[model samples]
Target: MKTPLTLLGLVLLTAASCSHESLTRPAPPPGDSAERGRELARRLIIVDGHIDVPYRLQEKLSPEGEPTEDISQRTAGGDFDYPRAVEGGLDVPFMSIYIPAELQKTAGASKALADSLIDMVEKLARTSPDKFALARSVDEARRNTSEGKVSFAMGIENGSALEDSVANVAHFQKRGVRYITLTHSADNLLGDSSYAEGAHRWNGLSPLGKQVVAEMNRVGIMVDVSHLSDATIRQVLETSQQPVIASHSSCRHFTPGFERNLSDELIRAIAAKGGVVMISFGSGFLLQAAQDHEKRLREEAMAFIQQQGLTRESPEVRTFIENWLREHPFPRARVEDVADHIDHVVKLVGIDHVGLGSDFDGVGPTLPVGLEDVSRYPNLFRVLLERGYGEAELEKLASGNVFRVWRQVEATARP
Candidate 1:
């Protein structure tokens, strides 16, 4: 019944009314801390400095180089998988190419194992392009993150892979290894390890270690001081032109006398050099009680192994340890304890020097409560959020700190 002009007027009014309604609509209520934390995790580019995925896969591989467990889908064992990583909002997890310390005793074994692990990681990305991508640089990581894919950034856990050659530093850098932990479990030719008992071999960085550090700097590999002895760490701080990282270490304040964890002085030294100390998530690394419990269990288990004339790798020893653990369960560290480590580092060196390295898949059953796997990173964020960490601070802790160091290392490298 309306005229054409009237109809046109009605249409325009209705359109304006709809737009007004949309503009005036109230915002949805904010989610709870946990939900908000999860949202923030998904929105941020979370980079875990060390994750032992390659070594984990290597353990499960058949003799023919085929992986027994499919990581693209959720697997029964290990801390990493595509689904869990996506759920955890993990963007860049440095795949640890962990060469065993025993290989250091062998001439060519270390390099061979290192190459095989690198091949495995490359294959993971090649076979699962949609789920994973190899991130050779920070820019590539960011790009992969934007595309909703997990970036497989790599770090060699044991510098033994260098095989007594400084040139091997450049070789690893070319192979997409971004960082190298100078030693692990035992003193290699590079330096003394924190876990290696008795007399110190190198006292600090060996002559070859100094050259390796320099070569690492020249080739753009970030030096990792995770398992290095205290003296080695000190010398590495003095030697490297680039900032170093403790890829998977926690504070020694919580677990005193634990040389594996960085001391306050060392942490400060690392910070002064513009480095990051990526806090590990292992319960043993976080709590004195947990560390003591683990030490006791290890001693008892070893005694049992010796009594039975069995090696540590024997199935009987594994079962004995399993039963012992069931009888005397480990004192698990909570998510709050992890936050305390972060707080300790922040108070000591500020938030810019601390980040997560979550030695996941490598820590076995020792991961803290609420951070049992990669998918629980949001739990740590939630605890931090409750402790008054803002988005900017959380973002820096998530990846900004490490990315800054990484970028600086890359910039310092020469052609």
Candidate 2:
């Protein structure tokens, strides 16, 4: 075996020998293939269909002027910060206007969240029009691309923002909100959530939920069925007058334990309706091991809060718990496993109906290791290529297909 010094001497000798005229070697095989992918990803309109930046901004700009509680700066630390987004090659991200599901049944739920989240996106676009602009159409998304600006679009995670009224769906569309998830954690006026604690049951969409779907289509808002019960998914697929979108969901085929994923039946229904299912990178929605591990961790976290007599409603208690979870975190899925979901969606619903939708801040610190944050998106591209996705298909998955769907839906909108 060569000693360290001897190895260094040999390497130096090789360098000296290379000065001879006959030194010839085919241009060292091109660098990381991800460069090509990354360049394309950067130049093209890359989008994560959902993120929770408003939660951070709202937490920061609260009227009380930053919490007086266990107030750490990171309470305002979100995964998709502006500088990090540029570094990650993300050109467009549907900033999620997520209203807690429980609030919808209350008095001012719809108007409050709708006004609040929409304002957040508007403010971000206003403060940095050089960096981002609110895109109401896919054409605008591409136009923003030419201007070197990120497209900031909106997706309502829970239809509770519609406030159980047929008119509010269009209200959001006027605010530049594009899609609406018909249900969330608990059943809203729209339908039941896949994760809501209950036995296997089915009521599909209520009369109002069906009206919401029709109204969403008429207003050009893509009907998003992410958190909906399977029955509700079927209803939206059948009722939607335009292409539907599962804004941030994965294939149940890839991650068996997660109820949040779309089944083969649901996948086919969505694609059959000319819709797209942007695959989610959340560990809970991707791999079985990652999901089970995360579920156990959440249970343990809940127990810890209980033992400590902490309450979510208490600012101090919530802050401590949030920081605690951020520090401890959850078991991570691998980048390759995250790509495995992309592969599953492609196989299940063709390359024309898949895109990336990493639930960055919304997943509660349960992202994969290589995908620890939005900055690691290049790793996902690299892993996808390694898994055999060609450039053409990868382009469709990154954002092209989503753009196409948006265009078709926008062009066909009655609004």
223-257, model 1: which lDDT tens digit per residue? 99999999999999999988999999999987899
Candidate 1 segments whose C-alpha is farther than 4 A from its true place: 1-31, 305-316
Model 2, 1-415: lDDT tens digits are: 0001111111100000001111122232345757755765675568788887765555566576432222112234558766667767887888888777557658776668678878867876887778889988888887987888878888887887877689887788899988887777777777777766655334788889888888877778888888888888887777877788888888887566556788988888888888888887766566665555445545655566578786544455445545655665455567776676666667666888888888877765566777877677888877666555667777788888888788888888885
What TM-score would each prediction reach against the true structure? 0.90, 0.83
Error of 2 at 212 (Å): 1.0
The true-versus-predicted C-alpha distance at residue 399 of model 1, in Å, is 0.4
In candidate 1, residue 149 scores what lDDT? 94
lDDT of 2 at 390: 66
| Candidate 1 vs. true structure, TM-score | 0.90
lDDT of 2 at 205: 87
lDDT agreement of model 2 with the native:
0.70
Task: Give the alpha-carbon lDDT of every model.
Answer: 0.84, 0.70
State in Å the error of residue 47, model 1.
Answer: 0.1
